[model samples]
Target: MTPTATGIAPTTNSTPTTHAGPAIEITGRLGERYDEILTPDAVAFLTELHHRFSGRRHDRLADRMRRRFEIGNGRDPRFRDDTAAVRANPDWKVAGAGPGLEDRRVEITGPTDPKMTINALNSGARVWLADQEDATSPTWKNVVEGQLSLFDAIRGQLSFTSPEGKEYRVTAERTPTIVMRPRGWHLVEKHIRFIDRTGRGMAASGSLVDFGLYFFHNAQQLIANGSGPYFYIAKLESSEEAKLWDDIFTFSEEYLGIAHGTIRATVLIETLPAAFEMEEILYELRDHCAGLNAGRWDYIFSIIKNYRGRGARFVLPDRSDVTMTVPFMRAYTELLVKTCHKRGAFAIGGMSAFIPNRRDPEVTQRAFEKVAADKKREAGDGFDGTWVAHPDLIPVAQAEFDAVLGENPNQVSRQRDDVEVTPAQLLDVHIGLPITAAGVHGNVSVAIRYIEAWLRGLGAVALDNLMEDAATAEISRSQVWQWIHQDRETEDGTPITVAYIEELIAQVLGEVDRRDGDRFDDAAEVFREVALREEFPTFLTIVAYSRFLVDTE
Candidate 1:
């Protein structure tokens, strides 16, 4: 029998509540609404999650560094032979589709701000990726308030009033199911501290804090609403990481007494190594797995980070030129679909980050055509669904899938057995336009603009009709670093040395200052430090968040 919402509320465990529970300390400012979400049971659930799995997360992280160091020392990664047995088994399949995930034909992704939360729930997409990782700046206010808003959202009690007297509410006849994306394994939520065994106050795992609190508060509410605890796991690099998450789901479900397999996850194949281990990753999370998503921007960033000094062969051109149609990207996406369908899982497409600009007809038309073409290709290639950044592009993607699906829910049965891919094809970056002056300048401009917005606690920004996020900033800086590492020259025959790129940065910064009159020195310093570094930082947001983004830490 299904549990009632009240049945899922905080249980009176004899384990003791306050000082004996988690020893968690909230250093950030808490609003009146925070109490609703940060109850004793929620904090205990997060504490339990941290105590149980953070060690494994740490081990996987160390494994990441070891593997990356080997790569840096000229050891190229290949598909793991140990996991061949898991992949070679043709009789195995992932668990049957969970509730509210039967047909994810279209998913919209955004932060969980008050206004954006209302907008996302109202967006006509089939799923709303309530993102806290990339689409959000992890300010303390943003973090706690985002959780508060999500709590209200799950119970259908969400509403918002803008400072300008504008009111927004969820009014959709069939609102999109919410699939939350927490921070990656590398991040730590410093605002939430707990006492360790040695009596040191340590920051809690960001993943545990986000996922645990949400599941504790809303798991029963969602099951009552006919959905389960759905998640989009971001930036995982290996199957062992997937196994850790699967273990986490099992533990959380059992601890809360929710049914097993009620938690479903869609792994984001964002990193280069993860693309090579898709089948193994799915196999690890088969019981709790939903599908795999193509996270294109991060994939590009990963290639650049993994093979930074590998030469001109790995040097990519402009971010714009490296589209889905590019050879390496095509290989990755095709392999993803084939692998997921072969395992009887949904193969979701990447995000079309174009947001319509209503003021200009020409710009809007161009974006429409580009989005239409992208979605059409995905639909034709047998992707069950695709993602869009804006509600305006929903119909554009929906039309393509509708034409292909007709009355069908998904194309999971269409196993692409004929498709075969090799490691060289997935790593082929040799085919793309040569770097151009425009490309160099665009990277500098976009990085500065996005970082400045991020510093001001906004993650998603519309610049020239494209919705840029943290991934955009990462790709921009990483691409520049890659070009510098190779000493590559632009189409104009100018070598992309640090000095030349610094000149372009100065030019762009001057232009931005003239238009906005707000100094961009902080943003410029960040861009320079990341792009001009001898070795790339895994994620720029890590440094930025610690040094510049904290509000009350």
Candidate 2:
């Protein structure tokens, strides 16, 4: 079996003796002990999931496209008439929090690298969102090693040593609960291919690969430890998608012999359409639903992307100017709290993407103050918990939540019935703030830098004292595209055109320091394609990943 460019050999074998599943081929290089994570049984489980649910995933994605086309053609999203019953019924409630997820007051999110796993577990946060989505680059090595890291961490044997001889370990007496967040349904794991009956092979679904692999490997162990297979579902756009996840969870639990309803999920209301379907989404996954999170960064990006073609009224201001206090954002959060609490579910707040600069005390102090205020608002607004990017911000966020939820695990009982948000309020994008030249420059700089880092196999990067992930990068590039299409101008009366953006990209390249193997050139090209093209790309990461990350011959 000679390996191909993707590092695994192409085979036409319909049945491998190792398992009784579909023909599955590993197209990625297996690292040391990677075989343990990608065992034959686990691969069979992934194959089974792909066989059962991949078609529905494709259909749902097509539905997303059709909906996006409707929005582009002036059909604004409103509360669905079909799901009115689901939303109107007030007696129903979700399953609520599971064993280890009762108090997610402070969840520290990061990539699933070995060191990050140790640190996040040791962080004072109540939940460690083991991220395999936005914060991960999905390289073959990263995907495999992430599973290995979590494998070790779950068994209490994870550790790492730095090149400078420093040691890291999960040493906290009471570590945070682990909540794995897999990639959304839109992505595909190119390194693994599933061969259909006709000898045709296609990339495996990224969501199923991540979720199936982790759950297959760790579900029983987690149950033995008194925790369950908890998850954070990201980037869902409709109740149907939520139902798909719920179905997957049910099937997985049954297959693994775990008790029913042992799997709990908190859905991230990141998409514009999803905000309108929050109640329906929770209702679809009611038996397995834990809560809804304010995925604020992606939520902003979604608004800009969905309404990009609706003219100046839909155009957003500078990214910095769009804070939580903005009308639309406020409406979204308040509505989320109201809906979740009304349904007996926790209402988690958004991420504070502030990473402390250790050398600069003033900058660190300012970051802490800002995060404190942000968490304070969420806590006061009846949120059960919030998110912080770095572990250092955990204490700051926990302090705020602690001040409000002193002895209570959560404030799910505090219903926000006074909140009544209309579709107009949710669609109102009037920021009234002027877009500044600095905003344009910052967008260009951050997009290029973040893309460069992602191309170098890093998904989460700290730039300008904040953690920039795929979501933030989406906002940066989408804003650039939106501004140019809407003929937006900076405050000083300079028009935002492709030529001007090209000049800015050049200037930013010169200012940004390049490492030995930096991908700044490629990153700039990608930014230009996504940000300056007449037809907006749905996702910048998708374009970059298919081009740069996949190991093609």
Candidate 3:
């Protein structure tokens, strides 16, 4: 077992049978029924949760590179005056709605592959985010076939066929409520390796190997099918990465005896420093918190990688002109529905990645009237649920969260309390409107059509009708590397250069044909080496997964 330029090594008397120690080995290639999901108790519960929280996720990723070198030497991220007594405690609330997540209006995400996990658990959409991060392309055979298609979709033993023989399954009597998401805490799982407490050997936490192998094989079969072990948390920034996911969900509910608020989680206020620590990250996961989402293109690629070169008042515009009804994405979704209904939780909303082109009935009626005026403005701004990457726009975002939650399964009691926002209006990014040339050739044709479908293993594509992923190729190559280092210009003025994005990536890789012209000319030289490089990598799938997707020897 050798393979290394990223992973694969295990079998020298395999291991990881934890009481929180040794047995951290399983390196990679375990295909064709990956030992029913790399078991040995899911590699000893992801090597005892990466040897207990990989040192608080490497000291919160070295306090996120010392707060991105103090927001690149000017420091602006506000709201955390040392968490202000956990956001002034305002009668704490979080852990309440659990069991199949008490109706999540209309979720529906993608990529767990077995035909988008049996068409997102038969897509009626009451929640089915099931992605293994940015609609997956993790490629250790799509992360061990997305944990064997969510372990045959929580025991319904998933189905699929399609090499034009069309099959697919999950004829829902009850589905959707799956949640999952994993991979972000800056991804790793390089085929898995462990030895941490200083013996060194690393690469593991793709958020604790996708939440410790899906909470060690579906936490008691998704808590005896009433659905527990849910989660979505990705790219967190602070509330100390939500208290390192509330101490890895209280050490995975006391190492799977399961029951301490039976693992909930939602967060993903998508980093502009997690939208001013949304009430101290919902009071540090108020006991496995389940709320807060609006992750619009990774919150505009975390506000162009935390305000790159902080000038032109944090310039941003044209990643399809930033609209979640603008004012800095409506002050980060009205302060995430007033910090998740003032802590009772459940906010959600953001993602109508729109993909309906069944022979274009006027491009699916102008994308269903722009996803019905964006889910009737997130159900008239209180949200309780919203996301639809396509299941025919899930009854148009569940008929606008069922006309503002009718038989009321949620709205978490709509306490937006005339929301107040601020942190200079979530860094207002000088009220948007600028960059164009059709948004710089729609960010060089959606970053060379999503890095040539994420180096061919594919990570959710759909293209022009929308549904692109990997957070839309990381907000289209971080807005073409912050519009070629802010020489931005466009809208007929010109500037955005690097030789006009390498002459529009050689006229869009010479109109792609010869079997995808050398993977769109290696995805336009990995999108001009991470968009005309000057060092703003942050994450373009961590250097395109160690240079054009790993798997060496």
- True-vs-predicted CA distance for residue 139, candidate 3, Å: 22
Rank order (by TM-score, best first): 2, 1, 3
**TM-score of candidate 3 versus the correct structure, residues matched by position:** 0.33
User: For residue 125, what is the lDDT in candidate 3?
Assistant: 84
- Supply candidate 1's per-residue lDDT for 171: 95
RMSD of 3: 22.9
Candidate 1 residues 1-553, lDDT tens each? 1111111222122221224333555666667777777776676667677766877988999999998888878888788889889888999888746888888999898999989999988988999999999999888778888988899998889999999999999998889999999999998887777544334457778888888888888889999999988999999999999999999999999998988899999999999899989999999999999999999989988888888887777788888888898888999999999999999899999988777888888888888898999999999899999999888889999999999988998999997887898988888887658888998999999999899888878989898689999998898999999888888999989999999988998898777744353437888888878888786888899888887866542
Off by over 4 Å in 1: 1-22, 513-519
lDDT of 1: 0.85
What is the clash count of model 2?
Answer: 0
Q: Residue-wise lDDT of candidate 2 within 1-553, one digit each (tens)? A: 2111122443233333342334568877666888888887888788778777888999999999999999999999999998898888878999999888888899999999998899899888899999999999888778889999999999999999988999999889998899999999989998888765445678888899999999999999999988888999999999999999999999999989988889999999999999999999999999999999999999999999999989999898888989999999999999999999999998999997777898999999999999999999999999999999988898899999999999999999998889999999999889899999999999999999999999998989999998999999999999999999999999999999999999999999999987888899999999999999998998998899899988764
**Displacement of the residue 10 alpha carbon in candidate 2, Å:** 8.6
Alpha carbon lDDT of each predicted model: 0.85, 0.90, 0.79
